[model samples]
Target: MKTLLLAESHPPTLEHLTGLLSQAGYTVRAVSDAVMALEHFSADNPDVVVLGVDLPRVDGQHVVHLIRGHSQG
Candidate 1:
């Protein structure tokens, strides 16, 4: 199964998106913040990642930068 790391700060949107991705056959690992997102990114090494721009503490772009810094990806 394909794995997806979903970083969504809003609960309703998170649930809805998770459901949609799950229905489409993705094994989703949902997180509410950039910190958790990065942690999961390292631990899970998911094939896909969906991050919310309005995430708390840190934004999605920075998270992407951090992820890229951690790998050639």
Candidate 2:
């Protein structure tokens, strides 16, 4: 399965998440901000998006709403 991670800009955690997902045999796409997350969503079309709530520019709840809207409509 594919996983898209919208994680904090902290490098260590981001690296760890990527490593873990890769080890789990997932096709992982990791992005720091919400804009890139949306871009990845359109480009990668991941099966799941793991979003961080304290996101910059656009927050996670808004992302969730947008994804839901896109999925439904």
Q: Which ranges in model 1 have alpha carbons more than 4 Å from their true place?
A: none
What are the TM-scores, per candidate, against the unseen true structure? 0.96, 0.86
Which lDDT values do the candidates have, in the order given? 0.96, 0.77
Per-residue CA lDDT of candidate 1, range 1-73, in tens?
9999999999999999999999999999999999999999999999999999988999999999999999884
Candidate 1 similarity to native, TM-score: 0.96
Model 2 Cα lDDT, one tens digit per residue, 15-47: 888888889888778888778887788777788
Candidate 2 yields a Cα-based lDDT of: 0.77
| Per-prediction CA RMSD (Å) | 1.1, 1.6
